[model samples]
Target chain A: MANGSTLLVGIAQGIQRPSALQRMLPSATRRVLNVQLTELEHHGLVSKTIFAELPPRVEYELTDLGRSLLPVIEVMEQWGNTHRTALEQALAGNLAELPN
Target chain B: MANGSTLLVGIAQGIQRPSALQRMLPSATRRVLNVQLTELEHHGLVSKTIFAELPPRVEYELTDLGRSLLPVIEVMEQWGNTHRTALEQALAGNLAELPN
Candidate 1:
């Protein structure tokens, strides 16, 4: 899910990378994120620059456009955390109503 | 996509319904939205009450929890509209770089 990766990157910037994503996301998803990062760089949403080393190293940072999305992601995080119980209850209720 | 439908309902609460969703979304999706609205009612994210009519009628309204999500969806809408060009460019560039 490219869209999922996009949203994840938007959430990951300036935050610790979640262990769940690292452990649970497929290798193909990691590759997709790499590609998306490159595209985001090309579109000025993120930046990639080389650093001095025997082998070149790079860092990914959000550009201004990318930074603008932080508020949106924060809102999503807040919503997820606050509504988590409600969501759980809803999910449970749905399951309970399911036919055997 | 239940999540997609949830997001769409969040977007549609205060705004007029978009024709694209009405027409392009599958009937199954519409049914899902109806179910979600009912669940949302149970969770107090939305409210539904009977209205006076020969055949029962109901109108949906967001409760406090639901209203809280509007800002998040607005941010997403803004991001989508503002980045539409970049997204298009990224998609087009990806296509152009594809091997023949």
Candidate 2:
């Protein structure tokens, strides 16, 4: 949740074309997603493929390295879900409500 | 890796007293580590305990949720080590020589 990159990488866990990704994360600007994709690509976590057609089609998918990150991300997501209440209390700056 | 919290969580995988953690991450300031520890505690991923002793010692350990994150963090560490070359090239801003 801290880094936008994880969200992008999570969405790209499965092979997806650019347009689909854009639609999936409508709130994110194309530029932001593009930057994350580039970073992931550079890190060898994601790969990009361009299809030759009337208009070039681009698809993004996780590499072995990228796929390796899913288990971690999944755990993070699970933790976030399981502890949503505590996290919300913390975020609200209500320290007193937190359990010991 | 982007968020300092992950690094902190990774370090907290095993029970560690503050002094031990400080030794493990010598470069990090005490304030920074404290902030991260607070965040993790708030999120319910970590728990803290105080011992009634001559020095009033304190210890920090991962909760079940925190321990659950180990598998994911392991994968991330593995991925980083495996793809160190591509990541380094990207960081160095050398676009060429990157495998396709």
Model 2: CA > 4 A from native:
A1-15, A50-57, A67-100, B1-15, B50-57, B79-100
Docking verdict class for candidate 1:
acceptable
Q: What residue runs in model 1 are displaced by over 4 Å at the alpha carbon?
A: A1-64, B1-64
Give the TM-score comparing model 1 with the true structure, all chains together.
0.56
DockQ value of candidate 1: 0.32
DockQ of 2: 0.39
Model 1 chain A lowest lDDT segment of ten: A15-24
After the best TM-score superposition of candidate 1, give how far the Cα of residue A86 lies from its true spot, in angstroms: 1.6
Best by DockQ: 2
lDDT of 1 by residue, A1-100 (tens): 3454444464454432333333434564666656655566556566566778877665566656767666666777778888988767766876777788
Can you give the lDDT of residue B34 in candidate 2? 84
lDDT of 1 at B29: 66
> Candidate 1 clashing pairs?
none
